[model samples]
Target: MRRELPGLGSDPASVRQRIEGMEQILERMFVVPGINKPVGLDVILSLIPGVGTISAAALGSYIAWEARNLGMSKWQVARMAGNIGFDMLLGAIPVIGAIPDFFFRSNTRNLRIVRKHLDKKHPGSRTLDVQATPGA
Candidate 1:
């Protein structure tokens, strides 16, 4: 089994970094020219036939799971799960889901929750870094 993150429940800096890295990849890894909006692996992956939507949704769940690991409240975790669920539901549809996927940005939404909760609970943990790389 994969090892639990060190100090995940009590100290979340390292865990936050790891989760933020993942959210960065999943939510906003690329920019649209001129329009300047960003997109990422989750949106790209959902465009694939079969497997893709499910995979993106599964990967999206990791943030919520990590939040639970950090001892976030059940309500907070449930909210995170709901965001992922909405993304997944929209993503499961072909063609129509694309625009919503671009706008909804559920991974980023969930990361904000994690950050908010961490800021309240962990106190000293650095702010969550969800910004996509420039020109990516």
Candidate 2:
């Protein structure tokens, strides 16, 4: 007799998988395709007038919620939100924004933030604690 949890329900792995998928979308589709010439879905979809960037940002925001479930700190969530905000704001600035989107991927940055925190909290993962040093 066990009560089921809410979001995660019964699988921690699914949460991890989802985060990984989002990271891939950010890295492969949004960032790397431009340099490598593979032509990702994100970039192709971004050809639309306004729907492209907005939809991508909405999709990326889910990672922030997932990061919270994974025990990420408020600062981490803020960083994720900031990344998405910048992606959206700058993404609206015509050609300049479009060019940056092909390189300066905020979703990837957010994913890295979540992964860094997860690895810190979970056992058997990389334990790199980031702390302020003396006289920096």
Candidate 3:
């Protein structure tokens, strides 16, 4: 029997959830001190010079890969790949790499692309956003 990993489903809904979760982990996992901005593994990993940038790029590429798997058009996939490539280049710079990586969230951009596609092509996968009431 083949074993399926959690969050690795092939359905559109599953894929949507998985990519959203990944984007959260890669782009909004933590809050920065003082500046009060959200950051995630993408920025944090890019701080380790060579290895970190590569690792972060690889993770970013996974989003593009998922986009391709969702039957997105070649142009969209290429755009996604371009986003990841540009991010990788930005991250390759030494000393100040993480600064731009913090602001330019390639994974978040890709997630937006993926969500657009899913919303149009797989409307059934649409999920409602629930926000908490202030001081409720």
Best by TM-score: 3
For model 1, the local distance difference test gives 0.83
RMSD in angstroms, candidate 2? 8.0
Output the better candidate (1/2) by lDDT: 1
- TM-scores, each model vs. reference: 0.83, 0.71, 0.89
Give the winner by lDDT.
3
Global CA lDDT computed for model 2: 0.67
- Runs of candidate 1 with Cα error greater than 4 angstroms are 1-10, 128-136
Which residue pairs clash in candidate 3? Answer: none
lDDT of 3: 0.90
lDDT for position 134 in model 2: 52
Q: How many residue pairs clash in each candidate at the backbone level? A: 0, 0, 0
The order by descending lDDT is 3, 1, 2
> Lowest-scoring 10 consecutive residues by lDDT in candidate 2?
30-39
Candidate 2 lDDT over residue span 15-124, tens digit each: 66677677666546433445543334444435555787787778878888888887778998999999988877766765456766666677778867866775666644
Query: Which regions of candidate 2 deviate over 4 angstroms?
Result: 1-12, 30-39, 124-136
Superior candidate under lDDT, 1 versus 3: 3
Residue 7, candidate 3: Cα error in Å is 3.6
lDDT of 1 by residue, 30-55 (tens): 77899988788898987875578889
